[model samples]
Target: MDTTVSVSAEPEKKPPTLFERLLINRNYAFMWVGMATSRLGNVVFDTALLLWVATTLARNAPWSAFAVGALIFIPQIVALLMGTFAGVLVDRWDKRRTLLWMDGARIFIVLALIPASGLFHLPFPSGSDIATFFQMGCAFFILILLGCCDPFVNPALLILLYDIVPEDDLPRAFGRGQVLNNLGTIVGPPLAAGIFFTLGIQWCIFFNAASFLVSFLNFMLIRPERNAQKEEVKAEQGAKEEKKAGFVHELVEGLRFVGGNGVLIAVGVSLSLIALGAGGLNTLNLFFATDNLHATPDIYVYLDVLYGIGAIIGALTVGPWVQKKLGVMSGFCIPGIVTGLLLFTYARLDNVYAGFIVLFFVGVSQATFYVSFGPLLLKVTPRKLIGRANAVIGQLSTFAGMISIGLASVLVTSPLHNKHLTLPGFTLGPIDTIFMVVGLLALTSGIQAMATFNDYKLVDKQEETPAEKSSENEDVSQPLISYVGRPGWLSTKKRQAAICLVGFLVCLLIILPVAFIAPSSTAATVTMSYGHPATGETIEGMECASTVATRQQLRTHLTLYVNGHMAALPTGIGIVSPKQPGVRALASNGNLYCLYPLHVFEADNIIHADLPDTRTYTLGQFFSVWGQPLSRTQIADYKADAGKQLKFVVFDGKGNEINYTGDPGALSLEEHKTIVVLYNSPDVHPTPFTDWNGL
Candidate 1:
């Protein structure tokens, strides 16, 4: 009897009911809420930090702009390497306890800012002088320390999310998380600006620190039965027949799994490309706003607000609809297309308002992209492997970001587009070219996504098979493919070391030239000294004189010496001698004296060292035979110390001093007696001996 009993395959277990799928017992909801809160806080913190750097922090110290950017990126590199180990740790340890530890660590780290702020103004006493070096050093140290903590927190958080959420509802959970993230973006900047403007940067830092505390408290409230059960199973497993693997072993397994999974590898590459494009756009946006569109600070703020508003709108509207309508791949394509079109138009927009409108659309596109990509990643990845998968994705993204940051730096700063270039018929700048390239990449990505839309559906259908599906009732279970393979050359430890090396090398290469050149460009050291020429009294020290002069004093010529010739002084109360030749001596009561030769010479109220037949020398060198420092107070006391014994000698625009005897303050009474010397010299070297001569 060859009769085979025909049995209809039970309709593949219809996906679980919505509540069962998402809530997945109480643990899923707890994990979701915890992750959402943490993510929200992080987004807010990042926005505030970036804004602070771009405005107040940079304004307070202009040189810190690049440092701020470095701080922001350094953390990302750390997170990439730590993510793999963090995932393994989550599996090995009590998930709830891990969450608590991570949150607690973050809270403590952030709260350190309170004391750090005070350190930012610490006074370094040197005799009677106070230096700001200590304060600036403290701020820099705190920022670097803060950067270190970010890696552990980010990976631990992602692992916790996987522990709580069921596989089926992962997508929707990610979508909701994206919404909250966008909400944070909308709120964080304005709040930061308001707080900074009103209470200063310290307040903004404190507010962000407080937010972590709130999230930590919220996490403590959730009690999950699944985690308790897992604890019991782990306890029962005990020390007999040990199965805990090394972190490297687990990390290798993760890499192997990702490499084997076509879907994950594709997504990873796509994300990398996307990050590259986004980075380029970031580099160009400021230039476009400031130089191309001529946007004021207020206008830039408005444009940022518009972008946030658009993102919020997209999160509320398009994020959910696209996910439901077109499957994950197609959903991502919509935003990609929008982003491309917006960027294309962004480059061409000449009006500031038009640029703002384009930025709004760009924000909308980014929000939608996040919604699609986040959920898709969650859905496609196995629950147990979520940490590794995310880690891999993060690592790839960081790699792309590093490359993009480099490319952007070179392209934007290079001579090709350092300034606006006027071609035969048109003008273009680096920013314009950047926009065009970003648009093209985005458009290409959109097309690629559309072409691969069906792949998502195929994967989705395959996930519905009976053998593939895990028990719906099971909670907090590990994945079937838990053991990842180790590649020979690229172990997890080596990979991490490689990442650190790459980062270090890139930073070293980029910074070495600047460091080498900085000393020459910056004020090397300031020196001040005071001494009494006649009284032998020592005065307070003043700062070392800079070669550059300030716009405080006006100069007028009392005489000019061109090849040893002199003339009568010009009529002006604001007359002063040049640093080089035609130098004038001012008495405490405002009398001017200058040396004059017996011939007509060219003279003017200007200061120029390169003037023909003019000799230049420092003011101190002209007054005293030796170069000696003088404090403002010492200058003020010069007449009192000299008394009637002071004999004044003045030089023309040149440093040669001539003898004069009179009451120091009585120059106004003897105006006719003052002789201004003019010497024959080329007009190219006109010297200003009087302040009013130029006018």
Candidate 2:
């Protein structure tokens, strides 16, 4: 055959859709489907929880708005506490295992809401604020657990994406993943609202639980491709890096740097104001839907669907153009100002369908702002302090959100709940005033951001060593946008690779305990199965049995540390008045007020197990009797604040101690075995007390 050369333009290959890409790789397909399924469940669960508490449980209560607002803020508080440590945790653990466990935990958490919902339906405190408070506490319990699980899931997913997908296709993979996530949010609302209305909140919860189980199965099928030796080398490198800089130290440096710099501080403050207004809108939106908009709860949930749809449109449409044409500062700030104005308009709107259009734009503005925010931060922040700067801003914004929600809750619950203030064009009630005030704040932040960063430019100083670099790293002149679009996308975990340019921005933008009558530091109460003032009433299946046995019964040692200081184990715990510590004139229904199965004879830490049988009691039983609240995040008056954790250790008779990771309230009070409860002291490995010293 003679050689014949035929030159023709090569046909261009079309890019594969998300489904087509999935068909090529089994592992990545599993991961993609798993994430989508779980995300859908999560959105539905969140919707159900919010509506159930706000509408069904606390329907007409004074602080119904506050309780509704707390649903969002409380989780932010938890993130502030543990989010920093998540990166380190993810680096250390098996990514797949972590994913599976997180899904499993959330499934259990969603199911628990069923019993939690029944707390409101209880006849004893029906239709009362007390019952609502109790239900809120129960709901908080689940939220806290889910919140703790969330931080680990996100980072782990990012790493797993790197592992299972081809490096070149990572960006498209993540972008498509986001599309699915937004889709889930779009569907989740109406689905949750439908299930919530037709079948009840229980069905909504069960549906979420089933979705998680489905996600779990898909993840289980995923066999990640890993090079064993390479992983070992990677682990060693990670450990070495961990030793270089601690989060606290870096965060302090970042705070100092940010505090001194005008632009950085404005950036931090502006981000906070944005979070505040967004949260405020959400917190009051339910009430706005029913009261001003004159819509039902079913109609109210659809607003989220609209918001999600608008987000997709904004991200695809105005998001890139804003950065390209308006510059980073203007891009981030302009949306803030627009959103502020929209919030004011929303405050005055009466038609349900019209309000929907307004909410859709609000989502659009927020998404546009978020699109530029990550780049703006990268441009302004030094390469080294990137993580630290982000952390500080995240913390500040979270606090702002928490404060806005809290303040709104207080204002609405006061005499202003029903009071209305009419302006020239519109009327202002609690919801209206809140929307206006938050709107003004957002507007102020946007204006300040524009003023401060209007002429800001990126500087190239990556070559300078940390010791040589100045605090204000604005020496070399360059366009801010020029700094990010470069090839060095595979930077650190915070900066993320090109794969995460959009996903990172989308992800970055986005628990409380109980109170009791006891003299805890705080006033939040824990939820109980049943409320009883009688001596022998059982709580959590542990009977308030007699502790009056003359002979020495089982005595378990108890110790408590609140904020690193040892709090005195209060006197007369589980006792009806004072029996031996002081004189008691107790006669209840022809019988003396008996001691609970777990009771204290003195103000000491020894918890006497005076049960007639050998049945062991839980620390929770003693807490219920003592009128104190106990949970992983809370103990009596003490709470685990930001960057702190609640932890405990259980000791056996052999002087062996194991750190207990489960519920603090569920700790068993074995004879002579000391148990220590420590809040906000993760570093101080507390040991159980050995010397009972004769009770």
| Best candidate (score: lDDT) | 2
Tens-place lDDT per residue, model 2, 1-695, is 13332222223555676666654477888888888888888888888888787656654445667778788887888877778698789988999999999888888888887876662345322323344567778888888988898899989999888887877778668777767877997998899877775566778878888988998999899988788865886788788676665756756777787775556766786787777666777787787776566566677888888888888888878888888997777888798788878877877776878888998998788789887878778876666677777878887888877877876676666534445443467544556666666666677667666655543455554655766554444442222222233334342222322222442233222101111111222111222222223355665565543324322246676766665665666444554432332222121224444555565543346676655565667888777776677898887666677777777788864357876799978888775577887677555555544223211
Model 1, span 1-695: residue lDDT tens: 23432233345456667776655556556655666556655654554455444432332122332434454555656555565566556567765566677677777776665553442533322101112233334455555555555555555556556656655666666656655666666665566556554465567666666666666776777664456766675576585226647668768878887776545655675577577667766644544664456553324445667787888887778777877887666777778777877887888776788887888888877778876776776666665567788878877877887666656556554432223434466445555755666676676556555544433343343545564455444222232222233455664334433543553454344334333422221121221222222111111221111111221211223333333333222211111222232222221122222221110112232222111122333323221311233222132223213222222334432223445354332222111122222223223222212111111
Score candidate 1 by TM-score against the native. 0.55
The C-alpha stretches of model 1 lying farther than 4 A from their native spots are: 1-45, 56-65, 92-108, 111-140, 154-175, 226-266, 283-287, 296-305, 323-327, 350-352, 374-391, 414-417, 424-426, 449-464, 468-695
lDDT of 2: 0.67
**What stretches of model 2 exceed 4 Å from their correct place?**
1-24, 118-134, 227-236, 239-248, 260-262, 459-695
Q: What is the TM-score of each candidate against the true structure?
A: 0.55, 0.63
Over all chains combined, what TM-score does candidate 2 have? 0.63
